[model samples]
Target: MYGRILKVYPGSLAEELELVPGDKLLEINGTRLRDIIDVSFAFADEEIEMLVEHEDGQQEVYEFDKDYDEELGVE
Candidate 1:
């Protein structure tokens, strides 16, 4: 499963994750992602892995390890 990002907050923690508007979310951890709710629950873990598609057609994988309940300020 996958979801496309429609918008992003400027200067938010999402920027630090290198997420941009229009990026295609491919996966979370090793599981397929479907929507925002899926993303929300998936990120509840202390560690996460994400596959993203860039506007220029580049695909990237990012991993994050943080405290539980920490918000990335993304939307």
Candidate 2:
């Protein structure tokens, strides 16, 4: 399962990674994301590997080693 990025906040990690509103979140740390609830558990990791699909059908991978408490700033 995958979750589409409906919104990316300004100055957010997603925005910093150049993610757009239409980006689809395919995976996190190699695990498929099935629902919103999974986000809390998955994002708790200080290191994250996110696979994103853009509206133009382009795919990009992002690696994050941020503070565990840092917000993703997305919905």
Candidate 3:
């Protein structure tokens, strides 16, 4: 299962990663995502490995080391 991105906020990590609406979030930190709750838990970590499938069907992995409070900025 994948969580679809509806929006990527300006000045957010998601924006920096070039993620956009319609992109599908596949996994975080090597764990496949099933729902928003999983996403929330995954976001608690400072280090993240995210796999995203673009609207065009291209898959990309984005890794980041961030402050614990920093937000991914996607809804």
Candidate 4:
């Protein structure tokens, strides 16, 4: 999925993770992300590993643990 982030909400988990608008969300725990719904479902787990591809073509991995119903805090 071309799961590009369009925006990052203030004080959100995404922001906490330093995710920015235009950052492409590549995967979650090695599973490719296809869309927002996919993101939501993947985030259901308390333990998450996000693969983010930046606009500069650099890839980064972010892992964190949160509640099952935790919000991404994005807009």
Q: Rank the candidates by lDDT, best first.
A: 3, 4, 2, 1
Provide the TM-score for each candidate, comma-separated: 0.81, 0.90, 0.93, 0.91
TM-score of 2: 0.90
Q: Give the TM-score of candidate 4.
A: 0.91
Q: lDDT tens digits, residues 5-74, model 1?
A: 7766777657888787788888878778877788888878888788888889999999989778876565
- In the range 23-48, model 2's lDDT, one tens digit per residue, is 89888888888898787778889999
Of the two candidates 2 and 4, the one with more favorable TM-score, higher being better, is 4
Which candidate has the top score in lDDT? Answer: 3
lDDT of 3 at 46: 93
In each prediction, how many residue pairs overlap at the backbone (N, C-alpha, C within less than 3 A)?
Answer: 0, 0, 0, 0
What lDDT score goes with residue 35 in model 3?
94
Q: Which stretches in model 4 have alpha-carbon errors above 4 Å?
A: none
Candidate 3 local lDDT, 1-75, one digit each (tens): 999999889999888888899999999998899999998899889999989999899999998898898888999
Q: All candidates' lDDT scores?
A: 0.79, 0.84, 0.91, 0.86
Worst 10 residues of 2 by lDDT: 14-23
**Structural RMSD, model 2:** 1.1
Candidate 4, 1-75: lDDT as tens digits: 758788898888999999998898889877898788888888898999989899999999999999878898765
Error of 1 at 42 (Å): 0.8
